[model samples]
Target: MAPDDERLLKLLTTAIVNHPRATMKDLAVLAGVSKATLNRHYGTRANLEYQLEAHAKGVLAQITRTAELHSAEPLHALQYLIKEHLTHRDMLALLLFENRPKTPPLENEESYAKDLDAFFLRGQHLGVFRIDISAAAFTELFINLVYGMVDAERRGRAASSRSASTLVQIFLHGSVASAASNLPE
Candidate 1:
């Protein structure tokens, strides 16, 4: 990313983190630029939000790719991604909140969904996830659960009651290989 792009992203992220409901004016002020300048860079509020979502999705995809390289199992890779996301709580909160906008979904959203579906499909093929569940449904469930945990943490609730590892455990509980099903592939 260009230096200006990085600065703009940081400013917008900071504004979102500082306020539950941030506006374009807030981001413009934070970036030390006029609203028109901001608009020139992003076109509109919806466009700005799309850029943010794309940035976040890129971050997630990179993390997932790295985890997949180091981990022996698809589930382990996903667990790593979850833990990394939780570590960046503020960014996740900003991304999650921005995602609720009424605008049409960004291109990055569909790509991200495809990547997640592929991961879930790999897990299902390895008998690590419940095969009965469609890849799309499994992906949606996992993403929603992770986002819910992040929201709970942001709300200052008993967030620590369930760590990312615990969430993964719960997610795979019924689908994990039992004693009888633990035979080597």
Candidate 2:
């Protein structure tokens, strides 16, 4: 994408994040550009959704790249991933709430799950995460927790950093603080 298009995408991303129900015209106005410019770049609402999904996927891929999912410490790897994810909470919310393309981005669901599944599996093997739960289930739980934490932050219930810690703790040890105290120290 050209620099100008990139700028528009960023503006549109912010607008979508803030006003999910806003129409394309509203988005164009929020982006400080005319509808013609938005149309010139995105062409249609579906196209705009497609581009937003692509942009979100790119951001997630970049976060995964930085989190170093292959690192030896599974719990730390998970924590790092959560921290990186916290930075993109708005984009995540937009992706969650927006109308996604029927085909999905990058043509496969694993585009979002591959790295997360690997991390969760490693954690389970290392006994950092529970074995009774399948990796896929654990990953889904983790994703949901992250989304809930993001929602909490949006509602001012907690800071993003605190939410990240809370998510990791709950994922690793269940909701009760004393639930895992019997484990080897």
- Of the candidates shown, which would achieve the greatest TM-score relative to the real structure? 2
Residue 34's lDDT within candidate 2 is 97
**lDDT tens digits by residue: candidate 2, 53-129:** 78777778877767777675887788888887887887777777766556444833465688788878887787777
- C-alpha TM-scores of all predictions: 0.69, 0.81
- For candidate 1, lDDT tens digit of each residue in 79-155? 78688877656567677775456655666567677877888888788888788889999878978878888877777
RMSD after CA superposition, every candidate: 5.5, 3.4
Angstrom error at residue 181, model 2: 6.2
Provide the clash count, candidate 1: 0
Model 1 spans > 4 angstroms off: 22-47, 69-72, 99-101, 160-162, 174-185
Q: Lowest lDDT 10-mer window, candidate 2? A: 103-112
